[model samples]
Target chain A: MSSRIDTKTKILDAAEKLFAERGFSETSLRLITSKAEVNLASVNYHFGSKRELIRAVLARYLDLFMPAASNAIAELQQQHPHASLTDIFSALVSPLLTLNSIRAGGTRTFLQLLGRGYIESQGHLRWFITSHYGEHLQSFVTAVQASVPTIPRADIFWRLHFTLGTVVFTMASADALIDIAAADFDEKNNIETVIRKVIPYIASGVAVSA
Target chain B: MSSRIDTKTKILDAAEKLFAERGFSETSLRLITSKAEVNLASVNYHFGSKRELIRAVLARYLDLFMPAASNAIAELQQQHPHASLTDIFSALVSPLLTLNSIRAGGTRTFLQLLGRGYIESQGHLRWFITSHYGEHLQSFVTAVQASVPTIPRADIFWRLHFTLGTVVFTMASADALIDIAAADFDEKNNIETVIRKVIPYIASGVAVSA
Candidate 1:
């Protein structure tokens, strides 16, 4: 049982790294097996297929992130029922940053995986996330809606999506943007700094009156 | 001469459609040739390579958009002398929508292509746009800076990128979102309506106090 779990983990680690660095469709299962140093049979045994492996890789992060983010928001709402949009968004930061503790660059990796998943896999990943974590996502959306009651739910819907686009696209290209920012502005930044920078922008955008 | 131009336009039309619908890396010269009903030699003759073809496809829209957007901003500055950030952002709406006049579904296609280009090509498309249309971009950035004099340049840089991500990601997935909105919220949104919806969100985000 331990050995089986070890093989599963080995496949996931190699898969996630490749998926994040390259992309889903571009990263083949053969390369993943080679990187994991496990044969084809091992991947098949562990994850059933490449698609399942992709889901598993993402689930690893989402499993950790969703509950933590939900808990953080829940805690914030309990403490400060009238929390501002920025405050609500800021609450997610700690949960997001804690991802780095799970792996060397877990936060960045998870986000990139997310961006890639959404962009590459058509609606499969979206369906997977929503079906699995609908309640958690709903909680976050509900908190934003509660903060801005005046905005219609539909407009809130659109704006929240806009906010998602901001974070998703930003995280997808975070590494390149970081390198460029460092070269052009002499500003050395990591994933945390970039995440912090985006919160205000998204918070403000989500709360803006339509 | 006319036949050559026709063949080139034929290739571009087919290439853009496939590239936007699928993606840059997913669409191949052979597929584009098959869709265009032209030979591979024609694409090679016209664009030199797939990378160049992608650039050409984007450049077609940018050539029209960059100047029109700049001129719109220039006109806004000339007329108002102190246009607000919303007004500055709103100025580009006409230019963006004007893309439709050039082709059916052109606005969405151009935006989708831009999103795909940025996401797929790593830094190549970014480099192409900046190098080719640097002045136009700088002017828009300068106008934005003028509106938000209080915000730091670096903050503006970050926010503008946030804004780009918002627009890019939103448009990339606009078709799906529109479908969902129609089904769930009963909101019928075309590309124009979506663009208008995002303008306020981005304008507010761009000008928000740091």
Candidate 2:
């Protein structure tokens, strides 16, 4: 790859790792630069600001994950026109797993970064995601709504955010939970296991009657 | 309150607000002292360390909520030995709301501090809670297990954590979600409304078949 591309990639890699492990506001530009082995000027020149850099870091994963997820949902609908909520949620599993091939621990890292963004950014990141990926999100929400037709629209809105919390917070703390489970219950788990484990819980939660 | 007690309360009041708003790591002793209008020496004298201070902030609420919650669960089981999982989870609402009587916005602030504690402090705070309050936790878990005897113990473990993520993340961003709901659906909500809505979702989730 070209030097400029290499520089940008390096910064993103460092930023994503720090942002996921630490947090958005807690991770400083200087720390990122030091880790990326690039000067402050490179980050400034490439991303313009810390906020943009954070967005770029997330956009890298969302750009790949969002359309892929939407396509997966579309395929599921075509295959089973009357798919259940669980089926619809399960359809995204493959796309989420595909993130692992893009980078080592990509799935967990992306999710942790997302959890940090929502919890720390105070709605800026939420707005960015909704505005940028509203179509994809809307498609997913519509699929969910159709599956649980009895649930009112406003209720679906709340349940979806509840679902977001379940997935994001779980993934952000996946490592810790895994450790506890292993020590306490002697059950081994990975990202895939954690994802599969949460699907039923959230699907059931979303579909439950008011 | 005596002068010494006043200083301790002052530090805790300021610390909890900042920790809930910004985060645990992001908020420093200096900032907390400044906000509390107390000297750093008083903070050290009372709490001994920042970690202890964070624990104290959470413990203040947990000290109240845990026993009350456990008592609520016991009462529900006493009244209806076969109470559903929804009943068990719903029983928490009263004890949680009692927090509001303790302080302004206590319910939201306590839950947010918890989310921050779990997400920001890594496993330290988790260890603190489980170790310090294991009896209360076990009683509640046993109540849940009795309600859903079909689900394995290990699965219950995972589902409970998933429920934690859902409630923690939801309450942490409760303001944002409430705003979105009001804007999009013209529905007004308060902390209690959100809590009631979540009980059904989580109760169904935990009781659903694996």
Q: Name model 1 segments beyond 4 Å from true.
A: A1-5, A41-45, B1-5
Clash counts per candidate, in order, are 0, 0
How well is each residue in B70-187 modelled by candidate 1, as lDDT tens digits?
9999999999988999999999999999999999988999998997777777668888899999999999999999998999888888899999999988888888899999998999
What is the C-alpha lDDT profile of model 2 across B1-210, one tens digit per residue?
Answer: 334558899999899999877877678999999988889888899999998999999999999999999999999999999989888888999999999999999998998888767766666888999999999999999999998998999899999998998998888888888998999999999988999999999988888886
In terms of docking quality, model 1 is medium
CAPRI tier for the interface of model 2: medium
Find the 10 residues in a row with the least total lDDT in model 1 chain A.
Answer: A1-10
Off by over 4 Å in 2: A1-5, A21-28, B1-5, B20-31
| Candidate 2: residue A160 Cα off by (Å) | 0.6
lDDT values, one for every candidate: 0.89, 0.89
DockQ of each: 0.69, 0.71
